[model samples]
Structures are given as C-alpha cells and as structure tokens.
Target chain A: MRFTSLSGLALGLALSSTAAFAGEIVLNSDQSDPAPKKAMEELIANFQAANPGITVKWNNFDHEGYKSAINNFLKANPPDVAAWYAGNRMAPQVKAGLFEDVTDVWEKNGLNDQLKSAAPSMTIDGKKWGVPYTYYQWGIYYRPDVFKANGVNVPKNWAELVAACAKLKAAGIAPFAIGSSQKWPTGGWFDYMDLRVNGYQFHMDLTGGKVAWTDPKVKAVFDKWAELVKPGYYIENAAALDWQDAIPQFASGKAAMYLMGNFAVAPMMKAGLKEDQLDFMQFPEITAGIPMAEDAPTDTFHIPSGAKNKDDAKKFLAFVASADAQTKLNATLGQLPVNSGSAKPDDKFLKAGFAMLSSAAGLAQFFDRDAPAEMASAGMDGFQEFMVHPDHQDAILARLEAVRAKAYK
Target chain B: MSAIAAQPDAPLAASWWKRNQLQLAPWLFLAPGIFAFAVYVMIPIVQSVSLSFYEWDGLTPDAKWVGFGNYTELWTDPDFWTSLRNNVAWLVMYLLAVPAGLAVALFLNQNVTGIRVYKSLFFFPFVISQVVVGLMFRWFYAPNFGLLSGVIKTLTGSNIAILADDRYATYGIIAAGLWPQIAYCMILYLTGLNNINSEQVEAARMDGARGWKLLWNIILPQLAPATFIAVVVTVIGALRSFDLVSIMTKGGPYGSTRVLSYYMYEKALSEYGFRMGYGAAIAVVLFLIMMVFITYFILQMLRQERDA
Candidate 1:
C-alpha cells in the first residue's frame, strides 16, 4: 500500500510537467473582415507577448463555409477555441454537449455583469457557452444622390416610403436594389417586413414556433410586401445576383436604396461610393404604435468540450470580450462593439446607427441568426416566392405552415 | 488399373495449403481493394440510406423514425415536384449534346495545321470547375453588361436577363451546362473516330457517298460505343447538377432553378435545418429514377458481354 501511494504521487507529478509543456492553441474563426483580421492579429501578438509559454495559431473562413467546416472538424479534430453564432443557432451544438460551459468563467471574469443584455442568448439553461466579440445593426442603406435626384426624402412611415418608391420609378430609377439570388438577403426583407407589420414580440413568437405561420398578422405582412413587388419597383435583375453585386447599381445611381446591414459599407466603399453619398435609415414603420427594433447579430467565441488548451482558450475569449479588443475591432471593421465603453465611429450613418441601437428599448438578432436555421430557410424561400408572385400569398403561407410544422416537430 | 492404384503409395494426399492455394491467392490479391471500397463507398451510401428514415438534427441523440412519412410529405411538397420536373427537363435537354457532339466530332476529325489547338480549345470547358463555369455564365448573363445580353440587345433592341426571368432561368442554366457536356462528348467521339474502320469509309467514298448521307450510314454505326458512354455520362451529369445551380442561382428567382439534388441538399443541410428523413426520401426517389437507366445499361452491357 505504501509503495503504490508513492508511485501514484510520482505519476501525477510527471503528468503535470507534461501538461505544462503543452504547445500552441489552435483558434479557428469565421471573421474575414480585413479590419477585424488586422486587429485580431495585433491582439494575438499581444497575447503571445504576455504569455511566453503559450501561442495561438489562428485561421479564418467565410461565414457559411465556416459553419459546415466547424461542424465537420468537431466530429474529428476540434480546435481549442472557435467562433460561433449565438441564440437558437447555437442550441444544436449546446444540446449535443459539444461546447464547454463557461459559467464559472462568466462569473469569475465579471463578463456576466458586463454583458447582461447579451448573456441570455449565450446561456443555455443557466450556463454561459460563449463570449460575444462584436455585433452590428441591420437597416436600409440608400444612395442620397438618387433620392435627391428623384425629389424623395427619407420616409419615416410605410406610406411615404411607397410614395417615394413610386416617385423614383416615375423618374426611371429602381426604387430598391435587392438580390434574391442569395436566399438570405431576401430573408432580411422578410424579417424587416414582419417586424414592422407584427411588432417584435410576434416576430419572436413566430420564429420560436410558438405561433403558426398562417396567423393573420403574418399574412398581412406578406400582403404588404407583395404590394412592393406588384409594380416591379425593385431592380429588374434582382433575382440572379448577389447583394455585393447589386451595390454597383446603388453606387452608380441606377437604384436608390438597399436593405442591408452595416457590413455593406465595405462593399459600397469598394464600389467607390463615399460616406456622404451613402446613408441609412430604419425600415419604414408599418404598425402605427410599434417601436423600432434593430437587427443586431453578434459574433462570439467559444471553447469546445474536448479543447486541447482549456486555460488558453478561456484567456483568449476573455481577451476578445475586453474593451481594448472591442474598440480596436470596431475601429477597423466598422462593427458595433459589444463592450459598453468601446469607441463609436465618426461617420454620420454609423453614429446614427449607434445612437439608434444604444437607445433602443429592444434588440433582435438578424432573422436567420435569431430563428432556427430550418425555419429561416423555409421562411425565406416563401418570402422569395411571395415576392415573385404576390397573388400566391395563400399558397405561400400554406407552404410555410407545412415547413414550420415539420421543423418544429 | 493396378498401376494407377500403386501410385497412391507415392502421394496419398496433397498438403492443406496446396489444396486451398488458388482460392487463398485470389482473396489475398483482392483484400486491399475490397477493404478500401467497403470503407469509403459502400459504408457511406448505407449510412446515408439509414439516416434518411430518421428525424434527427444531426447532433441530437434521439432520432425518431418516420418511415415513409418523409416520402409521403415529399410527394405533396411543391418544391420537390418542381425540382423533379426541372431535373427531367434537364435530362431531356442535355441529351441534345450527344448528337451535337457527333456533328462537331465529324467536322473536326480531319488532320489540319493548328486544328489540334482548336479541338483543345473546344474541349477547355470540360476541364474547368463547375463553380468557374457558373460564374462565367453569370457574367455572360448579367443583363446590359453581359456579352450575350449585349449581343441580344443589339440584334433585337431588347435586353434579356436570362438568369433573372423565371421563364428562361432553367433553360439558361441548361445552356451553360451543355457547353461543357458537349465538349466532353466531342472528345469521346474524337477518340471513337480514331478507332473507326478506314476500309469502310474508303468503300463508302468510292460508292459516291458523302456529307450527311455518308456519315449517317457509315460513321454513326462505328461511333456507337462512344455515343453510349456519352449518353450515360450526360444523363448522370444532368441528374446530379447541383453545383452550378447552387453557385449561380441557389435555386432562386423563386426556386425555379431548383433540381432534385439541390432540393435534397436544401432539405437536409441548408439553413432549413436537417430534415434528414425527408432528404433521404428525396434521395430514394432520385435513386429509383436513376435505377431505370442503370438497369437498362446493365442489361445492355450483359448482352454485349455474352455476344463478345
């Protein structure tokens, strides 16, 4: 017995020393934003400087590709830390027990207090699963010159916006430049229309599968959206193009407005459109008394369950949640920082977006991110079909209802 | 008889190893290839088939078996029907490549200076990735800016966004798909042309046969093998056309461009969540449809084998 006890003690010491000599942590992310990439590289450099023993090998992928690749990677060789979306989007992995619960870290690092509003989405049941790095608000991006040329002002209400679209159409300009070529872009339109028509609570309920898609309010929203499609007020080639591809039309003053997120600024700049030329506004109000809620989807980081370097991964997540990292990331990427003290951009549109987001009573994640991917996909397809043939509202609602039934089950 | 009996003393029985050598040798030679095929091809197909009968979000532990429910739902699903119809249309239209390819092959079969370069240039599309082809077609169909649209606008005084309009979206995609497929068929026929009987062509020429009549009577019969293979591959390509449609339109312009393969993917893996069972049902239907061609091909091959 005495000999066995000593042997166990010797083995434990050996294991501890071996763990202490562990190599670099692999950090996989889906952030392809140039500014964010540079800021993250700088942060990684700082992390390496602070911890001489530990290193980080970071890799990035496009958002859609990253989701599939990460799922595949986790099945075999999961990274130490990886970026993921929050809300119902993370529910599958969390339920699978693939993610490591960071509840203790949340309390210990005081991130729970710092991110009180965002914590609910990150927490599954009672444990925090991820740390949000940055988020952005979604709205309508319009070309001011086109609006001015058509003698149209930024409409604060639905009727005025419709009238403005008519004026633009009369002046031989596309009222909106939307690309249904990518299904997700069309989903943004559906979400905005739904939010304006039915209010935030109903939209949430509908996505959460607590309400049927055939509900009267949902039909009403689709009806209103159908009216926009009736006169072909949108760009003629909206069907077979990507959102980025549609930016040139807005930049060249061929079309006036684009319904998109703040990330659209990069593409607008790429098209040689100046900040003053491009501006934004909240989606026009549909319901008289309903409050405006911004679509603010956040990008977050999490540690997988079988991470190689748990301590190092935790340290990285905490660092990303820090004000310094948020400020740097926002400054570079034009993203709204999750951290309360992060600096705001000087651009008027960004400042307006920031003001609108900060003062808003409620915030919703983008439709696709907030809802389960299944519901969002089917819902978006229904929206596209409705847009193409507004007369098929009944048929579209029925199909969506069928999908929701299957999805919820 | 006595001499033969006496030989038993010389060797009563052969060794066990010697008796089984023929059987064992063949197994030993086949072991590596069989093991690899089982691991990669056979296993995944079986797994996908098994996954189709259950409703699991890929990550969940509990998978509910829905049996034929997925199939039943798919039958009534408009998107599924539309995709199925589109795939049929694709198959029928894609068959045009076999004849078109033969025509090109006949035209370019002769030896001429720089003719080889022209042939290779014609074959270029087949070597490029479908993603690149889709992107190229997208640019070519980009309304006013696109080359094809520009030419059409000049000729007809009207612009056409081939990819955008529902009436022409599927055909536009099919036309793009045909570009590479025709090239593939052309190469196959060119190789077939090399193997044709020179004596028969000489005899036909002596008999005053030329042009369409001469080619139809003599040349086509010789190229049967190449045509068979071309038809088989083209049919398969048309049926499995998900990549181009996905990259170009994503079954958009209101899902008008959706084919069975893309529809299956959308059902199983897209943001629409993993309706594995439903996707499997779609797969099973697609498999059944492909099986018709497969069965006919197998029968024809068997008949040829017997004849040979």
Candidate 2:
C-alpha cells in the first residue's frame, strides 16, 4: 500500500514536470559509473557556467538498463539531450526521426573541422544528427615484462603473432586473456580479424548483412582466428568468464595480452599492474595490402525530437562539442577526445590510443555497435562457438548467414 | 444492528436487503480482487494472443497483420527447436527435485538438538534470489578457480568449464536450479511430515510395516496435498527456467542453452532489437505447451476436489 502511494507520488511529480517546462535543459545519460558520472556532472557544471541563463537537469542511468530504457524514454517523455552511440547503433533513431538533426549546430560551432574524424559516424543522409564526445581504440594490451621475459617480439604480422603465441605457450603463459561468457569479448577478436583480413569495407558489409557470412572473405576472417584458437593460445573457459573476470589472468601474469578497448586500461591498472608493466599495440597486420581499420566505438550526445527545450538542447550540444568540453570530459573518462583540437591526455595508453585511432585508414565501430542488434547477437554467438570449437566453422557460418538474411529483411 | 433487527422482524418487504445481504456480501468483497486480476493478468494474455498474429516492433506506431507468419517462421528456425528440446530436458531433469526433496525431508524430520539449524541450512538456497544462485553456480563452474573445476582437475588432471561446454551447459544450469528447488520441496514435505497422523504410523508399525513400507502405506497417503503442491510448483519452476540460463550462459556456445522464456525476451527486448510480434508468437507457443500440463494438473485437482 505504501509502495503504491509512493509510486503514485512519483508519477504525479513526473507528469507535472513534463507538463510544465521551466526553461531547464534535461539531459539523460548512461554514465552511471563513478568516474563517468563525475565527468558528466563536471561537464554540466561547465556548460551551466558558460550559459548562466540555462538550467541543466541531468538524469543518469546505469549502462545496461539504459539500453533497454532509451526507446521508451524517447517515445514518451524524452529529455532535451541523451547519451547514445555512433554508427549503425544510432542509425535507426535517425531513420525514425526520433533524433533531431543537429547539422546547424555542427555548422555554427565549426565542428566540421574540429570533429572531422567523427563526422562520417554522426551524419545521416548528408546531415549530422549528433556530436560524438569520446571514442577509444581497440588493440592488444600486453604485458611488456612478460614479452621480454619470454623472449617474444611484439608481433607485427600473422606469422609473427602465431610464433609469439607458441613462444608464450612454451613459456607457460597464456597468449590471450578473454571472457566470452557475455559473448561480446569474442566479438572483439572477430572484429579485429575481419578488419585486418578483409579491410574495413568488406568487414562493415558483412556486419551490416550486405555481404553473406558464407562468403570467402568472411571465411578468411574465421580461418585466421582459427590459427590462434586451434593452438589453444587463449585462456581456457573464456566462455564462462566476463571481461572483468579475465583481467586477473593478465594482471597475475598468467596471460600476456588482452585485445580490448582503451576502457580496459584503468581496470588493468587497478588490478595492481604498474604503467611501465603494460603497453598497447595495434592488432597485428594480417593481409599485406588491406589498409588498417581500427575499432573505436564512440559515445555521443543528441537531441530527441520530442524535447521541449530545443534552443537549450542546441546550446548544450554546441557547448559539448567545444574543444574545452571534450578535453575535460575525455580526460575524466580516460578516453580519446573526438575533437582534433582537444588537448590530448597525458596518460601513455591514452596517447597511444589516440595515435592509433588517428593514424588508422578508417574507423569501424566495434562489432556490436556496427551491426544491427539481431545480427550482432547471432554473430557474437557464432564467434564464441568458434572459439570453443573452431572446427565447426562451416556450420556456424551457415547459421550466421541465415540470421543475417532474416535480420536484413 | 439492534434497531435494524427489531425493525426487520416487523415487515418482510422492508427487510429484503437484510435477507439477501449474506448472499451479496461475498461477491462484493471479492469484486476488487477479481477486477484487478482481470485487468492486469487476463487482459494482457488476450493482448499477447492477438499480438502473436501481427508483426510489430515494440516501438513502432503501426502493427502489420502477419497472421501466423511468425509461427511459420519459427517452424523453420533451429533456435526454436533447440529451446523446445531444452525445455523438455529441463522438465524431465527438474522432477528429480521431488524425490531428492523427500529424502532430505525424511532425514531432517527427526527430532534432534540441532535439527532446526540443519533444516534452515538446507533451506538457505531457496531464500537466495535465483540471480544470486545463478552467479554462485557460475563461479562454481568457472574453469580455473571454481570449486567444482578444482575437484575435476584433482580427479582428471584437467579442468572442465561446464558452462562453456555446449554439451553440458544446460545441465549445469539445471543442476544449479535444482539446488534451490529441492530446498523448496523439502520445506513443503517437512511441513507435511509435521502434520502426519502419529496414531496411524504407530498402528502401521504395530501391524509390522516398517521403513519404506510404513512411509508408502501410511505417511504417503496422508501427504497427498503437499506432494501435489510440490509437483505443481516444481513443474512450473522447470518450465520458467530463464534466470539461470540468462545469468550463466546467456544461451551461448551457439545459442544451445536458450529456453522459450529467454528466447522470447531476446526477441522482444535485448540487443536483437524489438521484434515484439515474433516474441509474442514464441510466448504463445510456450503458453500452449504449458497449457497441456496445466490442463492435466487442473483435471487431477478437480478429481481430488470432487472426491473430497
């Protein structure tokens, strides 16, 4: 009875607030972690200080809940600005006209030049829909001390990587630390392999379901992955562990490397590894002529079409796009700022990540973000299966092809 | 009441409301609860049945009439077959909880100094949320550091990651689910034993019945209601086995662990992007399968009611 009354009171308050907008800008974000939450609060503070007349209201949600909640929130009582992803992750929202076109804001703020690298990801139908704040590069985070102790060179090619894994195994260390229980960690391996083996366009096409999973190019990606999987280079029972659970293997020196996004650095450091103990390297070259395309999943802010405070939302977006804002935000996030003019973070991994991402021929959003959710789910499942049973390559690809056909339709 | 009773004895026409009040009062008392159930539960089931015949992503304004198209698609979808097979496996294996619970209840039914503590300790798993149970089992079956893996390694000279292996993943989860379910059934049986007719058992013993014979001839017949409830709950629990699979494997190792509930959720809500109509179709199929057992159980319940 008490719970019902309390919820009723909450509903009443929410309805009243939505009914009457008091020139306040409401921002909903999925930066519920301590660090990212703090960064968001600081960004709001800076934004409010810059525009004193504007009052900002921020509602933060946990990462997982936000994904399921966003659609409902957007359709119902959408905030003025909300945090979302880039690439195909954002494309559906753009198509439904649920996200506001922020091209004018981009043009007015000179973001075309400032956030040029992020333009292609943010644009839909030749118009920008959102401004990307931060993205982090994916690469191999390895224990240099272990590599040195094992007499393993930093692998630069497919053969070298294979040889390094063999040497690591010989030295009684696991070559890779992975946890596929969540199924997405396996997607990372597939993404990097596909990006290298077939380059960005073919990889993107495959994820988008434009290219069949049974195609030779797709098969080549799996064949390369099998080289590592068949050798038992990865830690055992990866499918039973989360990404965080796999970190102990690398931190305890049982495993030498982890191919992960830059977000993993802080966790690795927190696990008691010193800065000098660990280093980042690009996923090594596979196909000689194929250009290097990096996985740099981006986080961005956008205006919902149903927003009451359009002017303030535009102001917030413009303020967030500034070099000052992106620099402050990404510094706290420990990620690479999307703006070219933003001051680079001084951390070694961040410096390396920024360089790797900037030097890449193209940026493919990570597998889950790049593909439609249905295909991503099926693809990740196949990837995890392949990791466990690489010999089932043909059957897995055939299954994936069926899912792709259905999802695209 | 004194004034009304005195006045009601004076004229039949004036006392009609009082005469009918007993008959009307019960329905009046039940009206609110019945109305709530109809609105919240019955309406949604009807809505879902209708939704199964359409193609609509949850977010969309328009729903396209698909008329059994989703079911036709499911006919060819291998995941549907996998989920159905897993459901059958869950139902068959999960029934082990009944016998297992009976054994535990029999063991703990003795009057001892620390018997209450032992009973509570055995019942602890049911009190823990299934999410916690799932996590605990995930840790237990985790490859390197898990307790079970440690035992396996000691015995076999190699570690086995049960949840990671497609062949054993569903069974591992079902085992975890059974730990708590058995506890639940044991508590029910313990209560049933406490209420058993002591005189009948003594008479059975006097007639030379002993052990299993005593239990079968005397105690078991008296515990029919408890057994019925336990079987019903266990069957329901087995059919609705989603949380464990979701937490442990997420229907992974190539979607080998998916059951109807998890598949329906994945189709409608998760990163698969909302295929609400497709999800509804899956739910309808699950509901139909459940109806078979539900109908049989209800018929047996009706027979028992008639006899009573």
What is the alpha-carbon interface RMSD for each candidate? 2.2, 1.8
DockQ-based class of model 1: medium
Report the C-alpha lDDT of model 1 over B134-235, residue by residue, as the tens digit: 999989988869999999999999988888777898999999999999999999999999999999999999999998888899988988889889999999
Best by DockQ: 1
> Candidate 1, overall lDDT?
0.83
Which pairs clash (backbone N, Cα, C closer than 3 Å) in model 2? none
Estimated TM-score for each candidate: 0.92, 0.92
TM-score of chain A of each: 0.92, 0.92
Q: After superposition, how far is residue A336 of candidate 1 from its true place, in Å?
A: 1.4
lDDT of 2 by residue, B1-308 (tens): 89988785678776687789899899999999999999998898999999999988776577899998999999998888999999999999999999899999999999899989999999999999999999999889888788999999999999888988889999999999999999999999999999999998999899999988998889899988899999999999999999998888888767899999999988887766578999999999999988998999999999999998
Q: B262 in model 2: Cα distance from truth in Å?
A: 0.9
